[model samples]
Target: MIDLLKEWIINIASLVLFITAVEMLLPDNSLKKYSKFVLGLILMTVLINPIIKIFNRNFNISVYSQNISRSIYDEDTAKSIEKYKEESLKNTINNFENNLTQIIGEKLKEEFNLSNNKLEVKAEYVTQESKFEIKYIKVGINSGKVQKVEKVKVNIGEKNIEEKDKLHDDIKSYLSKELKVQEKIITIYKL
Candidate 1:
């Protein structure tokens, strides 16, 4: 609390000193003699500086009381966090697939400029008897509602079957005309 007060006082004092030094350099006349120095000092120190100090005090109290650093995570906490992240990502992909049917229904409205939501994207991974299959759907606005779908098959033993890379080429090809996404933007990898 004391430190905060000191900082605010320093800031206001610096500003007043700078303004007073500038005012002193002006031409010396009868009206500019004693009155200018006194008025400038009084206005800066009494009015502007106090108001600034009040604002700074309120801001400092609010920020300190908020206790933002209490949310920091440790190493074991970080590992559990990563586990949750992977699970959530898997659920997200499944939800995307389940929502695809309804999403496709709205594709026509989007493509014809009848709706503000212009694109619908869906992705899924299918574990087959001997291999893995990735499927992606891109529904967008073209002449009317246009839907494009792409599928990629990968063997279980393939090291390149990371999630992001698995569908990189297919997604790029599918949405090439609709979205100007760069190659680096799409990433896929297995957990």
Candidate 2:
């Protein structure tokens, strides 16, 4: 170690002397500035050589570079995985809503005899419970369309008016029971 220190000092001294000599010989021109910059770099390298040697004894450049690349690749892969998860979740929610709407439309036609209708289901995933929750449902039906003909011997005018009002409540109650949600979350409108 003592011999290495002595050699390092000698190398630094020689580099400094050479730099001084070169600076003195160069004329005052554009090249003088460039030469001085190069000499300064050489001086810095010589001065730092011993410290570099000591630290570099155990340092493997290839292994260090590989580790760096691996970390970067891992970060990129994690981001891609997160993005994929978000897209998959979005698609799942959309498909669930569409299928539910189709089922609701079919049921309305079969049970209520109402064909001209539009259904919108609002739902979201509850992260805390790890389940999906229905937020609200809106059903639009045209009143002028054909409805279920119930055969009851009563005043037809009053019965028809009563049926029109009761239809909204009945639809809301039906959807509430079928969806397992509160009655208030379902809304029916005559379009």
lDDT of model 1, residue 120 = 40
Minimum summed lDDT over a 10-residue window in model 2 is located at 155-164
- Candidate 2: which pairs clash? none
List where candidate 1 sits over 4 angstroms from the true fold: 1-8, 11-71, 103-191
Give the count of colliding residue pairs in each prediction.
9, 0
Residue-level lDDT of model 2, residues 1-191, one tens digit each, is 99989998999888888888999999999999999999898788777767877888875546776999898889789999999999988888888888889988888888898887978998887889988888878888876656787575666556223234788888888877877889877778766
For candidate 1, write residues 54-133 as lDDT tens digits: 67755443354366544555677899999997797689777765565354435334543334333444454554643222
Q: Distance from true position, residue 22, model 1, in Å?
A: 26
- Give per-model CA RMSD: 16.5, 18.0
Name the best candidate (by lDDT): 2
TM-score of each: 0.25, 0.53
Indicate the residue-level lDDT of 33 in model 1: 68
